[model samples]
Target: MPNSLNPLLQTHFDTALEHPNGIKKLRELILTLAMQGKLVSQDPNDQLASELLKEIQVEKARLLAEGKIKKSEALPAVKEEEKPFVIPKGWEWVRLGEVGEMQTGTTPETKDQSNYGKFIPFIGPGDIKNYKIEYNENGLSEKGLEKARLIKANSIMIVCIGGSIGKVALNDRDVSCNQQINTVTPYNSIFYHYIFYSVDSPYFQKTILQNAGGSATPIINKLKLSKIPIPLPPPAEQKRIVEKIDELMALCDELERLKKSKETKRKDLHQSIITQMLEADSQESFQKYFQFLTTHFHELYSVKENVKELRKAILQLAVMGKLVEQDPSDQPASELLKEIQAEKARLVEEGKVKKSEALQPIKEEEKPFVIPKGWEWVRLGEVLQKFGAGSTPLGGKSVYTTDGIMFLRSQNVWNDGLYLDDVARISKSIHEKMKGTKVIGNDILLNITGASIGRSTIFPLNFEEANVSQHVAILRTFTPSIVTYLHKLIISDFFQNLVFKEQVGVSREGLSMTKLSKFPLPLPPLAEQKRIVEKVDEFLALCDELEERIGKAEEKRGEILKGMVNDTYSRNCI
Candidate 1:
């Protein structure tokens, strides 16, 4: 290898080894080189591929004379315009059918019990994975084999139908395949591996897709498959290329193993750091590990999963009252709870809200975590003036209109805020009937059903009024001053974790109104709540910056890998 080429290959491999997609691209590059005759140097002493072509022709003629294989129609001669590239001096470009017998198989009648008793392996496209077929899951009887195309072991099979079209694999043993597979038996067995690598090349796959066109079910017929051009190298050069490919592919496997091992260690260390901060015995110990994280923010946040963990940790700390210090100067959370209770009692007496039955006292064992001083544990229903999910309008989706009152579904709610892109709507009369489910500005919406049960969002003041469906619930705080803090609490991991644990039902699990009403909420002093929200917003802004930086860094790395491949291939092809 040239000294200049070594660095390009190394840089490409080093940059992408950490990601699965990157390793895939690296494999594509390997196959690209092998197909282009760039993986191994050509030797002048080796016989020319044109001479090998004559020998392949002789073998084909002998097979035809012996009546072992059916004679295929002579394909059109290769035109100069059809050649994709200029090959080395000892190489030749020939139509694939010129050197191989390509045939499609069939399935026998399934109703005949006698056709199912034999032990002949029956292969399909799904049976082939990676580069070789290890075993066939189905079998055929002697009667079935009479109607099936029997391909010899080591022949190449390419899927010719549906989504698996162009998927090629080497048959390790003799088998009968379905109509979706096209088997290619080369005239010379020495060229089997060479042709297998060629058919698996990126160029061949692209050509196959181009021929498949835009049909509902893409397929490749025998004629189209045979017309695919092959760049044949001298017999000796093909052997050298295969050997080099095997050695380098083995190296790639080792590199992939090492990358995954290193990633596992990094994840373990990252989790340990988070655990240490969350389980700290004192504030001093917590800050020590947190400082280490801030100093190495770029290194730790490069992985998206790590950033998600950071986000979760921030939310957990906020709900635990550890995000901000307790203020002895401010009134305690017990006083706030008492004031909310008095307000709720007044509303029930005035007929403004419904009177509800008393809630069960929280047991000590049910408390998930300890709260800081000046904090109190209360059921979520205590602070809310109203709490209930909505109901779907009569006729459900049939009542929806293109332009009318907005209809909010579970999909409309996200962690940060409401998403209106896929929202539905109803007329003014329908909105009137849904008065109980109507939402207003500052109202928090929670998805209480199905896959997105824990998602919560606050409706913005500037948006038009809307009514939610059965999947969403509206939570109206008795005191409007703490709405933002309440919204944050709903989004916090502490609340979400509890919601998941208390969900009910079997077929389609849901968070029932009773369960949600009894959810334990950690109440901090009003003044401290404000401080905690501000601190969380500031830290979240920093996390957003880290995410943007990581995205750009990955984009730049991808561009470098792409440029290296394009530049190296362009220069080498000349």
Candidate 2:
């Protein structure tokens, strides 16, 4: 409704103002402005878009005569009622088929891996990512290429169907694409980039999705694409808009790169400060390091991820006996180890638990950090009464029931804790058959495989007799106090990084039971362990609160930025 901007500009900017999705939305706004003939002023002397369209039609007819492409049927003129908004004086509205040739790419029925010979870039929807074509270096064999349509460099490719529909890319070299993509080649050089930008605009993208009629895999056929209208700007102004857009987009890219670089530096700084505190030789040194971090807490803890790393550092420091002052009067870890060994022996002798295989001695080179006076390094297997994998439900889907005993999968075990709310249920009969795999209160569950490998959680008291899927392993402590310390230690950065590095497998990576049982842990004095757990929990809770506040602050900042951009456009339009 604002008259200051040409109606087309006002409408484009207004729609952008309503939903500033993110940085991506900002880029789309610039493109829409460029395509709608609002980004740059047109000179009265410059040739009109109608003249350019005539030249394009002549080229297309010549190409058709040469049999380069088939002659397309005459398209219906764009109706006056279908026009969305008024364009600038030198621009005209035209159907996309009037400016370029629309054609589908080829689809191979089958691929032979052995026949893949030379390196030629094969592009699919996945390859056309973020407006750029990423070519897989390996090329298909002559037989594979037999089924594909080859596209030349500079041709515009758009994914017409599937999950990546509406994505567009400018091919940098000759390439072959899958059936999901449609390729468009401009008839002339007058506004090739401008036309590319027009079709890739958010408006056209939405239109494509809406017009794509299929239920399963919605597709925009060549016929539908031929009817899509686009605003054609004069040649001179098109160049100017393209230049301006390139400059602004470069700035956005720089901002993203700088943000990521700064985040990486902040993480490194946080790690350095944590290392200084953990490696402090004496109480005074520890006090100095701690004070330094506390003084710059605001500077270091501004981001939620930094705060999370700090929380992990806090746990690591606690288990290493560096988080709190050690008491000389408390029983030594050496004595505690003896008690744990005796308990394990007793359990094995009473036939209450099975004895584990002999664990390898901790090598001197394997010790990552120096322990305090009363602390000792011990293998994790020595402290546990039982450590073994869970059982898989029999008959798969048939054994699963809606109202029955609970079954905890590896997915349910998060680093924070166990999530029992969405657990799968199995019949009581199945639960009874796998009684050894049944989880009890205070049982520690650890994910042994897949992407979320090494995540652990303590089972809550609510689930008394729930069994676990095979992917999860149970670790029951010999002493209740050791459970807390061990859980903290396993979740610490030191152990997690070690686990990630040592994980093995070609196809799927995970922690092996043999490797897990041999992991070295710092055992502090019994009383000191209790003190460390309490301090870690207190600090972790504080981190959680800080993270929530940071999330809310980021959301508010994004909204404010969107508001500022919107206000500027609104004022310009008025």
Candidate 3:
């Protein structure tokens, strides 16, 4: 391949390799090039499009004189300024109405049931798919056909109203459509395929769609649509162009099938590897799987969905004590639990936090997964200094202010962190009134109810203060250092499964404080907890970086495909 054309072809192929929609864009490029008279070389010996137009005009005049069609006012000539780009020699600029019989369709009155029956397919915007009319069972009776506009076979139908505007279809069988469609029956049968392809081009789509910007429901009348210009090629060239379009589209279909097949295998391989890592019971087996995964990280993490699955496995492994090794020198978690209890007692005595009901000791079978030698499992209630959800302020959202104290809701919390883009706010007085819900630095906020249930985040330490809504529970550890580790634990699949089961009520949607407190959580050594947090954060940060690269690749893929199409269209046209 020549140097200039080689890169375009490689980008085009790479686009299909990387993303599924790239093929769809490629199809658009094909249609655009076809319509621009650049898809096939011109044959000087072939009859010119201007001569074809003359024959089409003569056919239209004969049909009018034969009383087969009504004679309407003459269509205006195509102006030089109205033409979008220069056409090649032997091609001609022509108005859509100059060579076709245009008709707008209408629906019959719905109250008359007799007007509707299975007689002929009633084409609508929804019936148009990939440039062909899909024959839905919305047929009309003979009585309805009398009231409806008759559309001949091989007519190009286009939607002219609402969100489905600019949808076009070509029908081979006789059909009638609803009021939203306009059909053009070519005066000469030879022009049907080429005319359909022209109307289906991205250029035509843009021409009609540009008028739609400001309307609530976009619309273009039959007259305006008929006045649009078309670049007509000689009949032989038109045939060759259509043939090339079909061949290229078939290749696109093959590319899409192969891409999807390869993608499915990658996903299955990626997920199976992740599942094995999660299921491996022994340290040796887990290490084997982890090493294989790490060695092939680039291959496994190529797709965003694959990276997401890997993140889940990493989180589960972190909580299960499989991510890092245990050090014999670190303090055992049982010792730390005693200290947390002593701190909790001090808070209770200070009257700073309410003394909660005692939780049942975890039975041996209740443990979700085995922990390292230095770790112990404890009820979530045992380690917390405070636990409660807040109430919605009086008057609800009407009382919300532009800015004051940050009011955190379930929407603001995510597994990764707090997203305050749309966080609600309240006056300082309201924050003061809602003392039970006040949040501090390093506090773990958990969404306890509704669709956002189970999401948790650690409040930023640098921020002064914030408050929570009824759906979000404030989880303050007896020791502030445990906050980050606990937040990661709460978001892991191991803990989320507990949050979703056996709720306070039959709904199983709202997680009560009782259920949350009784939940079993693995407690690692203080130093080990820090290590686990660091390792987990590092893994998650890597996942984010991989996703960022994928996102940038996707953005570049789109820009390259679009630039290729636009550049090809511009260069081919002028």
**Best candidate, TM-score-wise?**
1
Q: Rank the candidates by lDDT, best first.
A: 3, 1, 2
**Which predicted model would earn the best lDDT?**
3
**lDDT (Cα atoms) of all candidates against the true structure:** 0.83, 0.78, 0.84
Q: What is the TM-score of each candidate against the true structure?
A: 0.94, 0.80, 0.91
TM-score of 2: 0.80
Per-residue lDDT of 41 in model 2: 75
lDDT preference between candidates 2 and 3, better one: 3
State model 3's lDDT. 0.84
In model 2, where do residues sit more than 4 Å from their true spots? Answer: 1-23, 42-46, 54-69, 107-130, 133-154, 171-179, 278-292, 338-363, 393-397, 427-433, 497-518, 557-574
Candidate 3, residues 340-403, lDDT tens digits: the string is: 9898888889998788888888999998667879899899988887788877899999979998
The residue pairs that clash in candidate 1, if any, are none
Residue 28 shift from truth in candidate 3, angstroms: 1.7
Ordered by TM-score, highest first, the candidates read 1, 3, 2
Better of 2 and 3 by TM-score: 3
Error of 2 at 146 (Å): 11
- Clashing residue pairs found in predicted model 2: none
lDDT-superior candidate, 1 or 2:
1
* Candidate 3 accuracy as TM-score: 0.91
